[model samples]
Target: MNLFARCYCRTYQKVFLLARRFLDFSEPDLLEREGALKEDLPATLKMTGLDHFFLVISKFLFDKGVHLEMEKALKERGIVLTIYSDVDAEPTFDLIEKGVSLYKESGSQGLIAIGGGSAMDTMKAIGARIANPKKSLPKLGGVLKVTHMPPLMVAIPTTAGTGSEVTVAAVVVDKANHDKFSINDPKLIPDIAVLDGSLLASLPKSLIAQTGMDALTHAIESYIGHSGTKKTKKDALTAMKLIHEHLPSFYKDAKNVEARDAMLKASYLAGLSFTKAYVGYVHALAHAMGGFYGTSHGWTNAVLLPYVLKAFGKSAYKKLAEISDHLALTGKEANPQTKAAAVIAWIEELNETFGIEKNFAGILKKEDIPALAKHAEKEGNPLYPVPKEMNAKELEKILEETMG
Candidate 1:
C-alpha cells in the first residue's frame, strides 16, 4: 500500500498542480461600516473557523448594531451569544477576571472580538482564561505558558492600528503594580482577522491621525528591525508603501472610502509584518511611555517614532539608506545615516501638522527614566537593532530632545 501510494503521488504531481487552480479565489466582501459589516455578517461567519457560536463582545463598533446580528446568527446556530460592551482603554487584570466569568457563564465555544486594538486584545485574553479555567491570571504571565487557546477565534478590527488582531503579544496593565505586562505567546494569534475599511468612515480626525501613524511606525520599524527576515521586510515595506500612498489622503478626507480601505489594508499588513519581524526602539520606548503615562498607544508611537528613527539611523545606516530610497527622500550626501534622519524629519513634520506634542522630559522626572529605561532594556533591548546601547543618561537625552 505504501509503495502504491508513493507511486501514485509521483504520478499525480502534474495532475495536482492543474487541480489546485480550480480552487475559489473570490472573497466575501468586507464592508466599511456596521451596516455593511452587519449586512455581510453571514459571509463573515462563512469564513470563520469556529464550529460553535459563543460569546461575542464589541467595543466601539457596538453601537453599529453588530450585537443584533451576532445574537441572531449565534442563536440560529443554537449557540449562545453574550456581549460585554465595555472594553477599557487599557485593560487590567480585573478586566480579565470579569471576562473569564462572563465566558464561564455563557459556556461559549469561541469568542468574536469586534472593535479597536484594546477590545480585540482584551477578548484574546478572555479566550485564554476560558480555555484554562483552573489557572489564575498571574500564572499566565510572561511568554509561552498556555498550551492551547480556544479551538477558533476571529478578530474584527474597527480601527486601523495596533494590528492586535494578528499579533500574539497582548499588553495587559497591572494597575496595582503600576506597570504593563506582556502576554507573549504565538498560540494567541487570532485564527482569522476581519479588516473592514468602511467601518472607518465615522472615525474622528484625531483617531485617524493617531492610528494611521501607528501603522506607519509598525511598517518602518518592523522593516528595519533585525528580528525580521526577507519575507518580513517585504511585508513591512509593502505596508509602508500603502501608507505613503494613502495616509495623507485619508487624513485630508476621513470619509474617502478608497483611502480608508488602503489605510486599513496597510494596518493589517503592518500587523502581519510586525507579528514576525517584531518592532524596534520606537515600540520599546512607546511601551515604556504607555506604562508610565497611561498615554494612548498611537499617540505614544506617533511622538516617539522620529526619535527611534534617529537612533536606528545611527546604527542601521545601510538599511536606512535602502529605506530612504524606498521612501524617496533626500539624504546627506554619501551618508547612509542621513536617510534615517530624513525619516525622523518627515515624522516630525507629520507630528507638527497633526498638532501632537512629543516631550517626555518634563513629564518624566530623571528618576523615572532609569526605571523606564531599565524596564525597556529588560524587555528586550536587542530587538531594536539600535546602533548604540542607550543607557539611562542617553535615553534621557532622547526624551529631552523629544520634548517640543
Candidate 2:
C-alpha cells in the first residue's frame, strides 16, 4: 500500500474502534450512575438553559456519520444542532470571533466541543462571548473576568491529550503580544464531556506519543503543583497509574484499541485532576515556548518534562518518589532525593523511544530567552507551587541545558 493508503487504513481502524466505544457509551443510567460518569464527565457543569448546541471541532475529527448520530441524539432531547468545523491549532482571536459570530447567527444557545485543546478553547470562548457580547476577547483574563456564559457547553476531546475538555481555564494566543493569555473563569468549565477511546485509535503515531506525554505531564505536574488539593492529589495519583500502565503500549501499537481506550480514560482522569489542581512550571515553560516559536504543545511538553523536573526535582522529590514508584524506577537504598534521578532518566528514555528529540533546540533562540522567560513567568507564575524560583539568567541556563 502507498503512504496514503496506510494512513487511511489506520484511520479506518480508529473509526471502527470508536463505533464500538459508542456501544459502550453508558449503560450508566444517567440518574443512578451520575457519580461514576462524573469522573469521566464533571457534575459541576452549570446548565445555561439553552435549547440547542453548536459543535466546534477540527475537520480531521469529523467522521462520516458522527454528526448525524449526535444530531439524532440531541433531537430526541429537543435540542437543535449546528456545527462549525474549522477549529485549528493555537487558536487565534479571529477564530474565536468568527465562531462566536456564527453561533449568534445560528442562534446556538450552547456549545459542544470535540477534538483537542484548540477546538475546546474556541468553543469556550464562543460560549463566553455569546453570553456577554460587550466584552472584547482580550478584555477577559484572570479570575472571574467573565461572569456569564452560554447555558450549556459540552466538551468531548477526540485526542487523549490537552485535558481541555474539563479544565476551567481557556488559552488563546495573542499573536500581537506573541504570548498565550488564559481566561480562568469558573464559568468556562464545560457542563458535559464524553471521552470515547474509540475516537483516539486513528491518531497519528507521533501525535499519539506526544499527546500521551502531555497527559502524563498533566498527571505529574498536577500532583506537585500549587493548586493541588487532597481531591486533586487523589485524582492525579490514579491518573498517573493509569497512564504508566497504558501509554507505552499505546505508543508501540497505535492500533491496539484496548491501549487506546486506556489512554483515553487516563487522559480524562488527568484532565479532571489538573482541572482542579492546575499545572506547574513544566506547562508554564511549554506555554511560553509555544507562544514564542509556535511549537507543538505536546511535543514541547515532552521535551521539557525532564529538564523542568530536574530543575525543581530537589524540592519536588517527595512527589517524584511516588511517580517513580508508579513507573517502577526505584532502588531499595535510594532516597527519593536521589531516586528521582532514575525517574528523570526514564522520562528521557521514553522521549527517545517516542522519537521526540529532547536535545535539539526546539523553535527557540538564545536571543529570545529574556523575553520568553519574563513572559513564561508572567503567564504561569501564579499557579505553579513547586517553583525553582528562576530568573531570566536561570531560565537561560535551562534552555541551554535542554538544547543540549
Candidate 3:
C-alpha cells in the first residue's frame, strides 16, 4: 500500500472508532428456545400491535412448510400474515425491489424473516427501501447511509451463519453490473432475533459445516482486526470457543439439541462482534467472488479464510496466537508463529472434514483475477480496519494462490 493511502485509511478508521463511543449499538431483544417460533413469535408480534406483517422466507423453506405452526398461530390471533418466499440464496437489487412493492401493497406494518441470511437480508433491504422511498438501493450503500429506521423487523435465522439478525449490514447484488455491496447502518438491525434450534434440525450437514465455518471466520476476523473494542474482542473469543466445541458435534448429529443451541449462540455472538468491529479480507474477497460467480457466501468464506490469514503474516501472528491459546489448540509453550500456524491448520482440517475443497481451482477463472482484486480492494480499504493493509496488487497475488 502507498504511504498516503495507508495514512488516510488509518485516519478514517480512528475517526469512526472514536465516534462509535457515543452511538447506540444496541442488541435485539432475544427469544431463544427450541420452540420460540411457534410458541412465542406470534404473541410477540401481537404485543408490537402489528395487525399485519410480511413473513419473509426462502422458497426451499416455504416448500418444506417449516413455518406452518407459526403461520397457524398468527392466523389464530387474527394477525394478517402475507407470505413472501421468493428470496434467492444471493439476493439481488431486483428481488428486493419486488419485495418492497409487495410490502407496500399488502399494508404490512412489520416483517418477520425466517430462513438463512438471505431471507433476513432481503427483508432488511426491503425495509430500507420502504423507509427511504426516495433513495435508490445503490445510494444507500456504505456506512451510515440509512437516514430512517426500517420497519419493526424480526429476524429468525434457520441457519447458524451470516449473523444478519444482529448485524448492521444487508448485502445486495447488482446483477446488471455484476457487483455486490453492503447497505450498512445501525437502523438496519432487526428489532428482535429468535433463536429456535428446532428450525435447524433438518438442515443438510454440508450447510451446517459451511455456516459454522462462516461464524468462525467472523469471530476470528473481528478478534484479529484493528478496530475491535474490548467487548467485541470478548464476544469474539466466546463465539470462537463455542464453535470450537460445538460445531463438529452439531455437524455429526443435527438432532443434537444442545449442540444446535450452542452453535446458534456462537453465531449470534459472532454477529455482535463483527457488526461492531467489522470483518476483513476474507469477507471482501468472498463478496467479490459471490458477485461474479454466484458462489455460496459461507463456502467462499471457508475457502478464502486460511489464505487471507496467511497473507496477513506477522501482522496477525500475535492475535492469531492468542486465538490459538483461547481455543487451546496449542500448548502454552508454543511460539506465536507456531500458534498462528496451528490456527490456520485447524481451519484447513475442519474444511477437509466437511468435504470443502481447498482451492477455487476449476471454479475461479484466471482471467477475472484483476477485477476480483479490484473489487475486494475497493470494498476493504479505508473501511474494514484489517490487521494488515493490502493494495489491489497484493490482493491479486492472494487471489492467484486460491486458484491452486
Clashes of 1: 4
TM-score of each: 0.84, 0.84, 0.98
Which scores higher on lDDT, 1 or 3?
3
Go through the candidates in order and give the clash count of each.
Answer: 4, 1, 0
Q: Tell me the lDDT of model 3 at 107.
A: 96
RMSD vs true structure, all candidates: 10.1, 12.2, 0.9
* Residue-wise C-alpha lDDT for candidate 3, range 1-404, written one tens digit per residue: 98999999999999999978877788999999988999888889888877999989999999999989998899898898899999867678878998999999999999989999999999999999999999999999999999888899999999998899999999988989998999999989999999999999988999999999999999999999999989999999999999989998999999999999999999999999999999999999999999999889999999999999999999999999999999999999999999999999999999998999999999999899999999999999989899899999999999999998
Can you give the lDDT of residue 229 in candidate 3? Answer: 85
Question: Which candidate comes out best when scored by lDDT?
Answer: 3
lDDT of 1 by residue, 1-404 (tens): 14564344334433533432453222223344435444455456655534454444555567677567656765565545567777757678888788777767766567777778778778777777777777656676665656656446667787887777777667788888777767766667876666666667778878888998899888887776655668668878778877877877888887888888888888887887776666766777777778888888888889888776675445667776777778787734646766766667777877777777866545666567777776676554433343344544556566666765
Best by TM-score: 3
* Global lDDT of each candidate: 0.69, 0.72, 0.93
lDDT of 2 by residue, 1-404 (tens): 24564355445434533443333121111211212222332222223445666888787666444455556555655667688887667678888998887888887766787788888888888877887888888888654678675557777776787877777778888898887878876677776777666566567888888888899899888887645667778778777777777788888887787787777767777877776666766787788888888888889888988988888857778778877776677865678887778878877887988899976464577778778777766655434444345545556667778766
